[model samples]
Target: MALIECKDASFAYEGVSVLEGVDFSLNAGDYLCIVGENGSGKSTLVKGLLGLKKPESGQILYGDGLKSTEIGYLPQQTMVQRDFPASVYEVVLSGCLNSLGRRLRYGPAERERAESNLERLGIEDLRDKSYQALSGGQQQRVLLARALCATKKLLLLDEPVTGLDPIATGEMYNLIKLINLCDDITVIMVSHDLHEAVRYATHILHLGRRQLFFGTSAAYRESSLARRFLGRDRI
Candidate 1:
């Protein structure tokens, strides 16, 4: 079954329609990259998928027993978020907050899950370190591990490598791919790098305030849509 589907969905930004006619379905283990220009509503669509906003028209459906709260989301970081004063372990352990629902304390399972994800991301050694003291790449790794603690089924990342150096960017992409390929978690990412998006994603969803293309990466590369974007692409 589809993990999530959007049927002629339309979304608004502060009550003005910004994206419309979106239609696609992501199945289990699918890696979808949402690509668009700056004002094309990519972030708005992510919010809608996360249930942060309701669609202005049409539907956003979730299947396979997936709930919005069950999605592990790693949003674009702001300066304040980057400067957050917290220990790495404390930050990651908070990803289990959604699963805790009426609970007041972290159970053994939650702590174990946090520890496992830290090890999974190869950041166990940073457990007791201060979050703000880490490098940009290391902080992102910590955040990625935190997101993993939220769900085993889906991961939603928005421009995950925004400020990383070339090496760190490559490592981040490799880690995300490993999560999808090995852990079998479904991934939906909003990205500006069309080249990288097509290279790593199994599928692509191109938006320009409206649905432009939806298909496999190979098909997208062959389509005129890819040519148009690549022509203007700096890469």
Candidate 2:
């Protein structure tokens, strides 16, 4: 069964429809990119997928033993989050909060998960450093590790590469690819970089306050939607 399925779903905000006609299916290990301009309901759809908001029409279902609560999420950071005063280890270890359930304190298992994720991302050296003290790329890596600590099956990222340099952006993309392809984890990402989205994603779901196209990356490249949005030269 697919890990996630959006069956003719739609969403609203304050009694007004912001997005409609959403549909897609994602199996394990698939990397799907959601592409659209600002105000196209991408974030609203994400909220639905994360179980934070209910769909106004149809449903978003989870199968293959996956639940929306178990998905690792790396949301776009605000200025306040960027300067959050906490140790790197503390921040990353907090990802295991969901796994604790009724437990009041983190146990060894959660600690080990955090350590494993940090090592997986090759950031063990910065374990004791302050999270706000790191560079943008390093902070992103730390956050990725934190997200990984939360889930082994899937990741949901929103504009993860937003305020980074060219090199840092490339590094972040590579890390995401590694987590998706090598780690065999499904990835659902919302991105503005159509070029990179085409290069990395297995499937593309284009939106314009509604689903415009949903298909393989190669097929998306050939679609008129791609031509209109990315241009032939860009694709």
Candidate 3:
């Protein structure tokens, strides 16, 4: 079964429609990339999917036993977030907050999970370092580790490589691909880089004012829609 399905989903803010007639299915282990122009409602669609905002019409179904709390999210960073005053360990462990329910403190399992994620991201040595002291790439790795503490099933990333250098961006993309391909996690990402979208994503959801295309990346490469928007750039 599909992990998530959006059936004619539409979203609006203060009754001004931003996205409409969105339909798609994300199967388990699919690396789905959402691509569009700046004002094409990509972020708004993500909010609707994450239940941070409700759709104005239609349905978003979570199948394959998926739940909102079980999905990991790495949001776009702001200047304030970049300078957040906290230890790496503290920031990573906070990903467990949603799953803590009424608990006042983290249990052993949560700590273990946090540590494991740190190791997985090759940042275990930096666990005690101050978050604000790290470089942009290091900060993103810490955040990814934090998100991993939330779930192993699915990950949602919004422009994860936005401000990094090319080397850092490539490293981040490889790490995300490892999570999707090796760790067996499903991925849904919102990205503006069409080149990276074509190179890394298995499925593409190209959103215009509406959903212009939704299909496998291979299909998108052959479609006229891709031609018009992306030109004839080879993946």
Best by lDDT: 1
Ranking by lDDT: 1, 2, 3
Q: Please name the candidate that would achieve the greatest TM-score relative to the true structure.
A: 2
> Number of clashes in every candidate structure?
0, 0, 0
Cα RMSD to the true fold for all candidates: 1.6, 0.8, 1.0
Query: How would you encode candidate 3's per-residue C-alpha lDDT over 1-235 as one tens digit per residue?
Result: 7899999999888989999999999888999999999999899998988888888999998998888878899998888987788999999999988779899999999999999999999999999999999999999999999989998788999999999999999999999999999898999999999888988999999998789999999999999988877777554
Tell me the spans in candidate 3 whose CA falls farther than 4 Å from its real position: none
Clashes in model 1: which pairs? none
* Sequence-dependent TM-score of model 1: 0.97
For candidate 3, the TM-score is 0.97
User: Which scores better on lDDT, 1 or 3?
Assistant: 1
CA lDDT, every prediction? 0.94, 0.92, 0.92
lDDT of 3 at 78: 82
What's the distance in Å from true for residue 207, model 3?
A: 0.7
Error of 3 at 174 (Å): 0.4
Error of 1 at 4 (Å): 0.7
Q: Which residue window of length 10 is worst by lDDT in model 2?
A: 226-235
In candidate 3, how many clashes are counted?
0
